[model samples]
Target: MDSPSSSTGPQPIVNSRPGGRRRSILSDFLSDSLPQPSSFLSTSPGIAREILTQDIAECSSSDDDDEQAAASDAESASGPADAKLAFHPNGIVWGAGCSLVPTHSRDRPVPNPHEVEESLHAELSLLRDNAILPPKHRRPRTTNAFARLYRRNFSTKVRDHEGPIVPDVAVETTPMLREIPPTPGPEEIERRFEFAVAHHEIRTTWQREAKTLIQYSTPLIATFLMHYSVTIGSVLTVGRLGLVELAAVNLATMTASITCYVPVQGLATCLDTLCAQAYGSGHKHLVGLQAQRMTWLLWILMVPIALLWWFSEPILAALVPSKETASLAATFLRVLIAGMPGVAMLESGKRFVQSQGLFKATTYALMMGAPLSFLQNWLFVFKFGWGFVGAAAAMAITQNLLPLLLVLYVWLVDGSRCWNGFSRKALRNWGPMIKLALPGMIMIEAQFSVLEVLTLCAGQFGTSQLAAQSILVTVTSTSFNIPFPLAIATSTRVANLIGADLSQAAKVTAKVSIIAACMVGCFNLLLFTTFRDLLPRIFTDDVEVIRIASQALLVCGVMQVFDAIAAVAHGLLRGIGQQAIGSYANLFSYYLVALPISLSTAFALGWRLTGLWAGITVGLLCVSVIELAYLHQTDWEVAAAQAADRLRSEDVAEVKLRRHSHSSYHMEV
Candidate 1:
């Protein structure tokens, strides 16, 4: 957060002086201890002054040619800063003179890499020992290759320019100077330098980042799979009740998911950012408050959705060719209305715990709830002879049951501190939350509604094809669960890298993620191809349903890679703050390309279920291709700059709010 000073001294080497000034130990230790100031600091305040000063003092630009060269250099440097502030966690301004460090270039002498490593280690120890930043806010440690390279590049720039850490300041008696740490001896510095450069290759960064991604995503994958199982359980149990029943359940769930479940999940996503910021900023109760607000908002929103469900039979009848299927779907939706509040709370509560880094809360709840849902489905549908109605009832009960388990886990185990019990506060200040919720809901809806549209289109082909559509939806959704969570993890990682001003590292991570996604896609592709005959049997036993699904499974198999790529690309777009591009691309590709191709081929050309999936497959391909192109063309450096600006703006807003009053400012999530 350091601002450049106009009257700063010429760059001075850590242990040397051009005017025979006495070299100070404290300056040298600080030079070695603080991580290198970012090369992207040319946009900071007073940088123009610094550049003009250097041009006048050093270039002696009496000639227009020399003046033009300096002007060009200044032009190149003038822009919004892309780098984050290099302020120390304990409030030390170690990078006070960062703007004065000549921008990195090929001409700069490479500093001893060992010295760089040791210097970074010292600063990392400082950050760790102080514990000023919570776990969520901690940047990557010095062990990361990119982090080391940043330190190395910083050392080279400061050494080449001889810029002081703080311009024109007394090393001794400086404000907030701590006891000087011991400096390395000549032998130690030389030895470490040799060691650093000798081992400077960052070959391990890929492996290290990959390992980190896998480890972080593993729990999420499990959690998402179990969550999906709740619905899959219903599909499996309901599919056993005969072809009509299976088709009814499929139609019902599709209606519920697109109209209710997906939107609720999407709106709840706002808390991912809101609650995390609250927890990281030490407002733990704000996390719960935010969740409560979202829950209430969703419940209020649900009033209309519930009403729609209650009267949806006519709507479904108009859209779907099978009036019987439409009526059954309406019945299922009406039954599901009883669980709307529970679904809202569960989605909100998941974010509540996830933001606190306690992912296992939802996992544990689903661990018990998933099987119980399955058992309930069995009892109601077969043992209890309730048929399709029984399956709907079981799913509704399970939906309600999940939030209770989540609440119990919070109260009994960890994450209880965030909750302060019910208050009218939850009912107040719905604007900011709504603003974030609407866009997220729209984005998620855009992604999911296309699939439901395809289902509606499939309903024209007869119940067998509709049942096959259900089987296809179930298989693909299950497959999608894996990469979707992985994509979330990727988004978090890439965002962290961008925020740290490590664009090169962020690019590397994006590559790794895309590669991982491709691998996952291929794995899914192999499974679908290999098990196409057997996969449908898990859901139903009707010969025609399985046959239609099997033929479509080939199309679904081809779609996997594209679907996987699209999922990861969406995540990558989110990480770089370019999700608006993705939102547009999804709407364009699905509605224009996928829908047209699907309708024309299915109805116009009489291609049946295969044509439906064929259209979706092409849409997936279009989406993936567009997303990847955008990601490829994006200037990561600018993205990082914008991210820093956003973070700074948020901090400024928070500070202004805190300055006015602690309690009077309406809390906006």
Candidate 2:
């Protein structure tokens, strides 16, 4: 019998005897010699067999006699013994003959060697002539499953040999398994980061910033509107008494706002910087103490302010020509004096609540007070015939109610977490509070005084002009309420960020606030310009007042844009503890630039109310430009460090004060 190595390729051996031992042996040699199916053919068994048969047939015809004899000898060795089969590269079966018995199994009869050899040779020749082989270049790619499996399992390399595809040990392995992707290097990661920054970073940042501004600004704007509504409701209620009453009450309200109310409000604003920074630094208790200090300071200051209101008659007489109007305005101021403390307290509470981001509490309190003030006015002025004094009394009641309700809410509701009751420490820290409060007060008072100066100029224009100016001022003040709260929100947010040591975030917040302020200004400009003619009808029926007020409104429309910018920029300055900068800007713009121009244009140039507003416009523009420039050039990192230092100093002060108090208590014991 021939050795297994003599087999040239895979072939079936058939016994030709009548009762032949019909067994077959599968040899590994035949599988090793035969061509493997392509990956494409392995997935389609019928096509693979047909192609294989055709290629093998063609190869067999061209093969030499020595090769044929070797195939025949290998087939003759598959007698009674079972053969171990090798798998094709494509995992197909190589031999298709009947099972052969083991050499020790004596029950099976052996087939004739010569007959088996001849039968196998004949079968081999037929299969060789009928089979087909695909070209090497046309083989399956590395991505194919069958090709990968074949490459992994096979020891021999698949290659073309003498016009037929065969397994050869000489060729290097063609790696069929897919190569693993390499990990991204630092350079690649950096490149991707740069791409994101260049393309999407700014847009994402702006969107987040705008959303944050809107979130904080919206509730604050609503709160301002509600607070302003109390005053407006009183104005509307008292207007029904007569034009003289309206003019008198309006003048008194403006005067009081400039001298008393504005200064108190400004003093309370010191809490904006201190409380906001304290809250951001996680010193929540300090925010409450700071607010308490402001409340005490404003109350102390209100003593002098109350005297001013009591003697308002002479001041009004000096400013205006009419004795009757001066007396009426003084009466209005005296009645309004009852609420001045409440206004100051309310402002302090508002700063405290705003620092803790509890804006809704203030909004709800004012919302309740605004309509209630109107109802009280209607009852006192119209129902009881108390006249302009009754309007002032009703407004006082409502204003006082605002602080009471806000204080109750803070003590009982969400904001109580920051409160540790009123501490003696509040009384001891007057220096720091006064330092910030004085500049903030000056900054705010300077701006309000510009309007007061213009109003004084308008009084010189006669009753019609004065009445028109009152209406215009009231309308502009109401509209100014829109951007005013945005400023407060901006200050709170910027201070919080700075105190938290997020300097870049604070800078970005300032920029976004400025942009928002400008946009609001543009919107106000459109609303004021569009409604200029119609808005005066709500305040008065006099044709001359309406005409003059409408013209003034046009100038106000332009001024609102600058007012919006200045308001927000002022808030940014306060956020970084730079209230002195705003104070200086307001002093320079309103006093040096605005007041002189307003006097010249109103008195010298005879431009009347329009010139007054024009001068105010120029002042606002100057303040806005200067504040915006300072904000743009400021180093946020330095500002953050300053905020930290302020907090640390306060802490040190508290520690020293506590030690002194403890030592004094021990000595007393």
Candidate 3:
């Protein structure tokens, strides 16, 4: 029994090449078992090939008169001059369909309907004869079944006219067709569509998704590295001042991240959903509204956070063994209080632009910020002779400047459509945002607070051990920036494939992602192990600090493999919408399994800084194992079905929203 294509299928796009193609060692028989979503051709690459080949076949025919007659009949019966027909296996034809690609320009025209249909039928028949398409997908030999299947998918108008296809009311009323962009002639669009389609068709699953993952991950990795440079600059500069200063800076940054920065970022992540939904649903102004609301909420929460930072000297003095390090750390936190609002706004602003698909804006802004941050750190700490206070001042100024640069980009270049000046609407819609924000904040803060615990544990040994802990943390963080972002990209692609009901394709993506993670982990392991002694010198001149840090690097180096695989596993969990399970796994592994062992090994057994990292490595290994097992056991078809169900619910809500908006407009008029 053949069914019509799902309404929640992927939207059309002209040319969206993910990256360069590469082949894998996987056998053709194995690769052929994995099937892509029906909508992928329209949205990905293959549709262009179908269009071009069909067009060429019809135009280059031996019978010129028959071709001319067919063309004339199609043109007259096509209804709209911009009508483009795409063929689906179920016999449905899509005409003048809107694209999902976020473009400011007009939509591109495609080949005529009759020509496309004929070409597709010829190709499918050839495939069937050659036994390329799996036996299950081959057309029935009986005419009765063929006619019945065709009747089920096609409109009555298509059967009656037997010329150009026309969509029914249900197809015409789809959200995609509601707001049609202007149309451009065929000459203006790229003719490389067929090339893109062929490239998509020939590649193995591993080869295809690996390239796509790289394409998504490369820029993200760069962005994370630059963003991390802000903290790196402060650590490197302060490490040179003294052992006490190095320990204080790391302690201060870790405390600040746990108590403040992590929460802000985590809370702001709600905008990733809110702003994206608003923009995609045509409620553009809501993007700014959501951002504004988040910013205001963060500012309100920061009131208590500011007070805590301001009077933190007494608290820190009691907590740490060294009074000098505690006082210095307190001073650093106090100076950082001014930068809280900047951090809040930057987090929100990133989501706002990202929601609109303006990803490069943040990258461009950070390109300027990273170098300036390093320069400011050098000038203030060394040139101006402000010491630790100068380092704090530079960090504060840089944080504030990042948001300003992002705003300037939005104002001058693009993404301004979402912003319609400040409005009071941001103040009222507080409940929904807060509910989403708190859970995310708790989860993030829980993960980040582990660093603070590890630092505190290391401090119990002595000042040199504490300083070594700082370097170890920095190296771990910098290494993490690579795999974490790659994981995020993997999650996005996998989730998309799942949503499209391409279970086999999603599985392929998952396998490719884990392999990529393994490769990254090995590279980090090599770098750390090979340069353990030399790497610590880049930060400080102190002999004891360098010696301790170099020793700890051996443990840290081994942790990288588990760390990368664990991160990618977490991403896969998110992609499958099984984040709760991953969260539970993290809590169990880190708290129940890692913390007690670290305290026992570091203090009781006297393994020192190396023992502290060993515990974390154990936790990461457990997380990777547990999550990978869950993924391997997951029923991918069920996951895809759940994703489709979710998409259908969202579509229903969107339709209602449009209807409500239409009614409101009518009432106003």
Candidate 4:
């Protein structure tokens, strides 16, 4: 044999017996006669098996094996041969050399199996004793049956390929042969665990807030829808009476809404800030007292409003073109005056319950009241022939019952914990409530006055136009009930967050509310736009009214988006105790920006009813823009602090009033 060339790298060891093929160096070295105990390689059995299998597969595929053997024989004849061996111990190669001994005989004596076994055992013991081999427990575990099967199939496929190529004999260390990576340290383990926990917590908090918003808003929206049905029912009943009656009732209803109903409703919203903050801060008793104070204040305010309703004919006459229409509207207003207190009281009770997060009670009360009011309208207007007067009476009676039902539910069913019973102390805290109520009242009044002005302008177009305007306003207002409760819920939820001193949470709530409102606005736009031709027919069957109202409905479809934005923004301001800013924005937008545009378009430019609505649209757009801009710039942390201060200041004032009362009593005694 000739010495293997140095540049040939490692060669596979072959069995020199007559028909035996080449085998891997690892298996050959283990099977060969060792010169000494130290000459044997040490490696895991699994790796040794893999290397053997790979080399055998490569040798089986080579066509040049005969040529290589002939070249080796020529080299052997020309020069003295040395055997070069490459040992792979645990898959790491180590170079070695040994002299070759040639045998001319065809047969060589086979090594005894017993002697070979003893030699292998002796070599393993020596390696273990010398610490050259790893301890048994430290060795890598062998591959299971699945891994062996995969390797067998893979090797079979690689060997059967038909090609002209030289096979390379090399054992590349794979992942199986490499040392196992060290276990992670305690610090890294802790860091990974903490990251997992934080990720879970963030996911959980988001789900919780989403659930809370849904739970709070759903019942509120339902309640608003039910309550709005009462107004729709009235409009539908009055429409059956005749065109003049429908126009009269619509005019009176809108006027009352602006002058009496909305003002009280606006004034009562002060409870949203007061009662919501009180309940959230755990001053539960203050919630009830705030409710009572709102009731008293609203009742007092209702005095002048009743006078306005009684004398509304002259007002309507001056604004409306038809004297008969004004007289019918006045009659309707006078009938509704008796129910103004009921409306005020009902709103106060609603705020009190809503502040405590008892939205379901409001929903239940409105559900009952809406149907009963509708039934009563059918009975009084259609069955008993009470006409517009019956519609107003039915509404007044239902309105009176609504507050009583809400109050009874709150006191007897749930929310009694917040009520300390009726208290004179509620009557004493007028100044603080008024301070908050005034700005809110101003903001609401400005918007309502714009609608009233638009209604007046619509009246100038004629009875048919006025009837159409009424139908459009009623439909739009009904649609408005959807986003309105969202605004109320936003206010309550934001106030609660502020009262709890969760500044970032309040900001998030505000943003979520605005986005939700805009989505609802889009929905309303689509709804009204799709049904513009059909919706007016619900209130009136008159062809002319339907045609005129359809045109105005288009304007309403565009306006609803801006209206929703402004409504929610106003609610946010109330929540953050910034009602004055909303008031100013409303004043400027409605009076300066919207009113002039509306007047010039409807009268000077002759756009009529459509132009009036166009003007209203411009006002709503201005208010929405201004208020949203202000909201974007607000610092929620400061707003939260202000809410806290507002609650504390009221407490301080209550204390001073008590002290003064006690001193006066002592002096008198």
Q: Which candidate tops lDDT? A: 3
Query: Can you give the TM-score per candidate against the true fold?
Result: 0.70, 0.62, 0.72, 0.62
Over 142-197, each residue of candidate 1 has an lDDT whose tens digit, in order, gives 34555445433332121212232322222344333443445544344334433432
Candidate 1: worst 10 consecutive residues by lDDT? 91-100
Candidate 2 lDDT, tens digit per residue, 1-669? 121112111221111245422111112112222232111100111221222222223223322322432343354333422110100001000010000000000000112232223323322222222221112232333345555454433312212111323344343255643333443433343343334323322111233345555765676556656667777777776666666666687788888887877677666655655665444333455567678878888888888888988988988989987677778889988998899878777878877776665646776787677778888988898889887888999988987998898888877787876676766666764664566567546656655666777777788777678878878777877777767667655665565555545454454566667778889899989998999999888877878878998988999899989988887777777666675577678778888988888888878998899889888889889898777666554556555556567656554543443344334334544
Clashes of each: 3, 17, 0, 0
Instruction: Single out the weakest 10-residue window by summed lDDT for candidate 3.
Output: 94-103
Q: 1-669, model 3: which lDDT tens digit per residue?
A: 111121111222112235522221122213423332221111111222222223223223324323333443454344322211122111000000000000010011122333244334323322222233322232323335455545444422112222323333232334543543433223222122223223332112344456667866787778778888888999999988989999999889988987888778768766655665455434455568778888999999999999999998888777778888889999999999989989888888887777665667788888999899999999999999999898999999999999999999999998886786786667765775676567667776676667688888887787888888889888888888788777776776666555534455566677778878889999999999999999899888899989999988998888999888888887777776676567778878888888887888888888989888889888888888777766654556666666656555555654555455434434544
Considering lDDT, which of the candidate structures 3 and 4 is the better prediction for this target? Answer: 3
- lDDT of residue 193 for candidate 2: 32
Ten residues in sequence with the least summed lDDT for candidate 4 = 96-105
By lDDT, highest first, what's the ranking?
A: 3, 1, 4, 2
For model 1, the stretches where C-alpha displacement exceeds 4 angstroms are: 1-204, 663-669
Error at 308, model 1, angstroms: 2.5
Model 3 vs truth, CA RMSD: 17.6
Whole-model lDDT per candidate:
0.63, 0.59, 0.65, 0.60
Error of 1 at 103 (Å): 38
Q: What value does the lDDT take at residue 179 in candidate 2?
A: 38
Q: What is the lDDT of candidate 2?
A: 0.59
lDDT of model 2 at position 5: 17
- CA shift of 122, model 4, Å: 73
